[model samples]
Target: MNQTDQLVDLKNLSPDALVDFLEGMGKEKFRADQILRWIYLRGVTDFSEMTDLAKSFREEISQRAIISFFTPETIEISSDGTRKFLFRLCDKRSVETVLIPMEGGRNTLCISTQVGCAMQCSFCLTGTFGLERNLTASEIVNQVCAVRKDYSVDNIVLMGMGEPLHNLENVVSALKILYASKGFDYGPRRVTLSTSGLVPEMLELGQRIKVNLAISLNATTDEVRDELMPVNRRYPLSELMQACRQFPLAPSQRITFEYILIRGVNDSQADAKRLVKLLHGIKAKVNLIPFNEHAGSAFQTPDENAIRAFQTYLLDRQIVAIRRAGKGLDISAACGQLKEKLENKLLGSGKESSLQGK
Candidate 1:
């Protein structure tokens, strides 16, 4: 069998699988737990660091199963204390992850699930990059492990480059690994998955994992949403709201609706009023994100006065809304601004650029 099939993502495997694999290699079953602690908790990269394990056992493990980790190719620190990391994956494709430091001892890590996005949101830079492939469960988990190893982050948001629901299985598997007591052990409440209203997946995720949910509800009407986010064409606003009603949220948990304010698009006071009506009786929080302009995007960020007026409209109706401000513009690492830089070496060497359109 190939390595991809025979070698499981050590993060995805249950304790039983680890014990079985270790026993097959002539090591005691208890050694599995010891090695797991070393990898997950201590964040040890070298087998030599696992001194408690027998040297022969460590050598055998090195020869059999591979322990994966991500090395950041580029790191950018925003003026607002936010950090973005460009990590090179096993397939040589690159993805970006961001770390945001919030007030009150809260830190959020925004992770990407795909190299590029298939959901072509009109204003998103990532959508312009086009689709590549869904990352393996290991690739997703390695992102968290890598960020945690390097920095102390308190929360996780699946809101970087690609749509999390599109890569549902792998994303959930990665979440399980992160939630496992033997692994990262992050509380489900601290992790939030953002989707562009994939209704079927939303229903399934609501039933399966009780993690926090954030919906990218940038537009109040179907006409506007379909123009901004193409996914709205498949699953319209009505159906999405119905799914939200069925979503199982904890007593104190309120669904977060992400609204990106675009000039001359969906930033009008009427849009804000319509949004308030659409979310009536549903426990929700609105995150007003001023559009971050990119090279090819025709949209511009909403004026400061317009953004404040919209925030005031929502608050007047007792709807909670907060503006999201963070770092990333300088290095193209902000929300919807992560794209891997392609080198000119291939072009100079008479090779077609694999990352040309993507």
Candidate 2:
């Protein structure tokens, strides 16, 4: 093992924990805040760049700790201004992050919580790889840090590769850092975490954090959801809906239920009605995503008419619904959709034309 590999990752430490850590090292609490500001706010990596810290303190910590960031192995940019970053972690395992930009100055960055997902959602490509390992709090936070350095990311969604609720502890730690005034300084409204309806974690997250919560609820029935997402079998629709209703939200905020409209599977007007009834009492909005067809996927994207009808039914019933426009299709922008190992698989096949890296 290398020397840096054994060093403690400063990015993994939360604000209070960081202060406690510095105090144990014979440093002041304010110094921890300064280090956070320099690392997260100022994007400084080197200990020497922390000008406010004394030379002795900097040198001492530099020998025992490190601030690590994922230098993206490749960055693929679509014509529509959507950028996908394939990040290789310290373990040599890879993860992906996508940056989706919209008009009216909205830029949302999608980050992962795990390298691959265990949820095994039928339509999602990321889950096929199975669970590799849960990402550390540092790995999750570093995705935002790496992207923010190059692009303007105002909104963050924990929805790229894995189920956010699966890695609850690290995810919560990462959220604390993201919202810390001394750290990323992101407002609660500016960040959203999507989960595959992990019932227990949903309640825990509600009690702890104030960020927007999104449920990857692709179906209205327990039978359908079970086949679509394995998690539904464990925490059925009844439990999931109860948890959603109980999920605390600000008066102005609504829990976003992401319903991927798969043709003939869950895109019917009948299904739409079931969804409205299911979300009847809860403060909710629906993001209607037509399935993005990938290779070897049994699911097909809903026809334009069917998709419109589903959204119309919800809108007619006083439900907030919007059809998410597809972006970055050219690059197979969805993580785990293009290649098995991003760097190795494509190089052998010579399908590099689709992926333009920066």
Candidate 3:
């Protein structure tokens, strides 16, 4: 057998899987815990650094197993202190992860589950790239671990580049690692999975994982939503809202409906009224994201007055809604601005080009 095949990546295994693998290797069950502690709790990558293990045992295990971690090809820091990391995968595919620092020392990390996206939301930058591939559980989990090396991330959002529900299995498997006490150890509430209203997967996610859910609900009616997010056409607003209603929620928890307000599209007093009516009986909070404009996006950011008026309309009706401030815009690290910079580098033209036509 190839030695590389014999070498298991401990980072890819869950605690139970690690136990089984170690047992099969004729090593003590406790070895699994020791190795995991060194990798996760201690943040040690090399076997030589795991001093608690006997030198001979470490050498033997080193030859039979390996710990894998993805290092970023480029780390870009925005003027606003946001950091975007472009990680080059083993297969040479690239993905971006971002770290956003907030008030009171709280920080949130945005992670990507897919290389590109299939949702094809008309206004999203990543949608323009189309679907490249879904990330593996290790690929997903490593994002959190890697960012933790720099900033003590207090929360995580699956809102980086792709529709997380589109890669449900791997996303959920990665969540298992993030929720594991012996792994990333992030509380379920602190991790939010944002989807473009994938009803079936949303229901499954609520059942399988206890993390918070955020829906990218850019429109109030099927006609408008179909234009903004194509996924809405398949799962329509009614069915998506029904899934939200059926989703089990812990006490004091409310689903976050993210509405990206675009000028001349889905940002008018009439639209806001329809949205209030549509969310009738759902336990929800609203995040009004004034569309993050990119070089080639047809959408324009709504004026502050228009955004505030829409927010005021929601607030008057007892809806908890807030206009989310755009971050990392200088470095193209905002919601819909993530793709162009990487795409420019990939093309090797060194000129800032939009993927809109491509």
- Please state the error at residue 248 of candidate 1 in Å: 0.9
Write model 2 residue lDDT over 1-358, tens digit each, in one string.
Answer: 8897789898898887788888889887888879999999899999998988889888999998999987887887889989888887876677889999988878999898997788898887778878879999999999999998988889999988888888998998898899989888999999999999999999999998888999989998998999999999999999999999898888899999999999989988889989999998999999999888877698999899999999999999999998888888888875676435465466566655223342
Error (Å) of candidate 2 at residue 112 is: 0.6
lDDT of 2 at 21: 84
Per-model TM-score versus the true fold: 0.89, 0.95, 0.92
lDDT per residue for candidate 3 within 1-358, as digits (tens), equals 6677777888777777788988987889888778877887777889999999999988988888888887877788888889999887876667889999888889999999998899998987778778888988788888888888878999999999888998988888788777777666788999999999989889888888888999999999899999988988799999999999999999889999999899989999999999999889888999998887777877899998899999999999999998777788788776536555766776686543334245
What tens-digit string does per-residue lDDT give for candidate 1 at 1-358? 5765565456655556667777887788778778778888998867778999888877767767767788886677878778888777766667888988888867899999887889898888778777788887778877888889878879999998889999988788778777767667788998999998899999998877768999999999999999999999999999999899899988999999999999989999999989999998899999999988777778898999999999999999999999987355666655546444332344456544446453
- Sort every candidate by TM-score, greatest first: 2, 3, 1
Q: Model 3, which residues run further than 4 Å from truth?
A: 1-6, 26-30, 349-358
- Per-candidate local distance difference test: 0.82, 0.87, 0.85
Stretches off by above 4 angstroms in model 1 are: 1-6, 12-32, 54-60, 340-358
**Using lDDT as the measure, what is the rank order of every candidate, best first?**
2, 3, 1
